[model samples]
Target: METPALEVQLQTLPSSPGVYQYYDKNQKILYVGKAKNLKKRVTSYFTKRHDSHRIGVMVKKIKEIKHIVVESETDALLLENNLIKKHQPRFNVMLKDDKTYPWICIKNERFPRVFPTRKLVKDGSEYYGPFTSFKTVNTLLDLIKGLYKLRTCNYDLSEEKIRNGKYKVCLEYHLGNCKGPCEAKQPEAEYNSNIEAIRQIVKGNFKESLQQFREQMKQHAEKMEFEDAQRIKNKIDVLENYQAKSTVVNPKITNVDVFSIVSDEGYGYVNFLQLSHGAIIRSHTIEMKKKLDETDEELLELAITEIRQRFSSKSKEIYVPFKVDAGEDVKVTIPKLGDKKKIVELSQRNAKYYRQERFKQMKIVDPDRHVKRIMAQMKEDLRLQVAPTHIECFDNSNIQGTNPVAACVVFKNGKPSKKDYRKFNIKTVEGPDDFASMEEVVFRRYKRLLNEGEDLPQLVIVDGGKGQLSSGVKALEALGLRGKIAIIGIAKRLEEIFYPGDSIPLYLDKKSETLKIIQQLRNEAHRFGITFHRNKRSKSALNTELEEISGIGEKTVIELLKQFRSVKRIKEASEKELAEVIGVSKAAIIYKYYKSKKET
Candidate 1:
């Protein structure tokens, strides 16, 4: 690997617009970053005095540095965002929060009402807020609607009354919740004034609005209107409760971002809490299964830098539960006292809580022990360059040379990423030629990946020894991924593992947890492949007669099968039973076959 090529490219870049990529020696991308001034930003890392520990580490591993200079900064920004999304760079600040924040939209009507929305529209509708908590936003919406009796219905009042001239006062008018302009029960001017009260309430101006309500209550009390005074007092109480609940924790810091990382074994979880004016505005969480050797401090530093680059800063202080050794002049503090402490404590608690949840669900996978050992032994046994993080396994299945299907299962960080699991029907090779079927499936898979210039898996395991392994390896090499990814042949005995080079079945060391872990992984892949193959065979057998019959096409066969149940039953059915099918005829040759088969 020409590792220095990466460093040289970074050094030779001109002070102009461009994008730069950092790739490991194997050409797998570590990070994708774009810069408006390519030479200044890319070359900054090489500065002797300015070399931060993180930058130094990144520079040392720069095996291949590629650049693309765009015409403008805007183009660079767009390209940067796109590449970040496409590659999901390991070092970039990722938007861990996939759930969108909600905004309140008020229709552009004379009597507008609030609606919760995730998307912003350029239509005339007005919107406010991107509230973090659904409960908080919903409660405020209800309180305002109850107090001011603003219409909650989406019906356009102005269009109904003016354009269509169709209107009516609702029950809210009788309940004294609304100033009823529709009924003409309250003056139009009074109703308009009530609308302004709603506007003030939503803008968080409760003091001014409450003071006016208080005066109204007092005047009613002086007039000996006890019932009216009590009603106004109740409204004031509701408003006071809302204000009390909306207490700002840290007024000095308007916007603060807090981060926390919890690690268990090799897995890491990063959590972010965004606070605006001392109140939490949003929170984000990301769970990672990284290399076991990657340190917590290193992961936290990378995660923080990535997050900061993605979310624009609104606060002067950034809180982190883990100590970051970035040495940046930013206020990096573990909360010691007061509300900041409480916020940090809450965030830590949440991170731990989420970690525990993941741990519980993932307890079935004991990768830390048996699986890791098995993989390491397999690597040494196969003379692999590194421990595999991403492994793809292939297996072919069929019954008596009947239906052939292939399965591909992916394991990331020693655990099955079932999302990437794939099943393929043997297209090129038919009738249970396991070796050729494996070749076709593997070839089809890698050809597309190589054509797209995609990353190959760290290891590819075939379910058979030399024959199957050779087929898979040849396919990979054809796609120019042969030496790039490790290849292993796992031919299983009744209760043991058989490798290509070794004649003896390799039973893992009984004492090693890692060995047992690898066995479990191999077994899982076998089980998944077998399951998919069985399903394919079963479906094919059931559809065999339909596939073979000429005049009895798909639709007719489908109707006959639906009405008769199975192929076995369809073949055994009398002609009358076949004729009873909605689309089948009494004189149909297929029905005669069914009748003859039943008689025999």
Candidate 2:
């Protein structure tokens, strides 16, 4: 379906590193991509079939092709990222992060001021971070305040103003919170030294600060400045405590960025762990909605570039779970063992937890979306033609070949529909023939539904192995519903799922939602069947006791039992009480029978 203009454009595309933009008929941007070979990459889209339906549709909509030839692949990547953000293309990878994170800004002044800011002002000042939370910013600020006495006032502390005696020491100086930098009580070199330590601390590196503080304390202690040394010791304790919480791996794993991804059919989550001196200074997980069903490598590469730029990370090396194209400047390591691998695994775990949290929030905020996602997932996992919105599970229950019965529990939209539960008395099948009982109940359940013009379930789950499954399939085949409705069997021992003809069973993940629902269905059917079987046995016992009387018919026995409530109560009751309930002749037979049985 390529137009003549597009075909000609594709043929003439340069085999150079560049970024490409696909536009629709109205000059509306659809997608943005970067490639080392523009011609080969663009040509493959039109030449080969795309597995993703969305990708195929986007390709078909491309009425115009635009190219920006860059000097290198890195330049192409940067250009692609910029253009995608500028145009906000419809089919580009959509990063689901929009929060304005806080950054620590060091003011460019004679007396530099340090504070947290959400806005990034382009001046001569240095900004350390765009931290994910304000609490972390506050914690670092508190640590700095506790360690060093930096002026909190916004007054200009220029040399000219201090020389003119324009400012005086404030209450903060009185409280020892500031060294009166405004009034020049604190020397510029000393304040600047403290700022340097603060910079290192914000970068999650406390070694230099700790070493300096220990030396200062040693010098103070040798000079008999015991109070100052004690103060420095307290500062070291504070810094070490903070460092202990931040450090996650071996101290040798320093200045490394660990990036790991976990994805599903609809979205991908990439967790970035920023480590400095083996300490995790910052961690973030970004969710990206899939466009063109992009591979993990593609998503991870793009995310790493974007996140590093966003967080201003300058790490030369990164640890990943797989190989990626992060440009020539960056070294990528696929960790296979030891601490490197554990960090990657920790990143993946964070991504998984984030995904689970998002799912939980979605379920609460938008239940319809939640149900739709689960239904779609169930359809794919169970390999059904459509979602099993209405499912019925059958289980047979009997103890010692007595009161044999089968119970069918219904589930709609992955939840139990208790009202639709059906119980079948094993009439045709005798003894504990589970296979025959299953076949009979499966046939009877559907046969009645068909007879009554009621809708059938989209799926049928038989609670047993292949024997029970084969029997259920036979019933479906007899009712001409083999292919129309999907059926599966669940084995209790291994939790294996079996299909109609496939001898091999499908073992789902132990933690998978699909397997959980199947287990719920199986357990529910068993519980319902067991309860029915127990009740049936109790009733049969009750009927045998009274129905065995000489003149008591089933109806008379029922009437007497309904009046007395139990057989023991009937036996305890006087003849006058029984006559008042059943009748004089039947009451006399029942009372005399019980008396003779008691005497014997």
Clashing pairs in 2: none
* Candidate 1 structure lDDT: 0.68
**Best prediction by lDDT:** 2
Model 2 per-residue lDDT at 24: 98
Q: Which sections of candidate 2 miss by over 4 Å?
A: 9-18, 35-52, 67-76, 398-402, 430-432, 551-600
Across residues 100-152, which tens digit of lDDT does each residue of candidate 1 receive?
66777776766665678888788898766666567767887888776765555
Q: Encode model 2's per-residue lDDT on 277-299: one tens digit a residue.
A: 87899999999988877889999
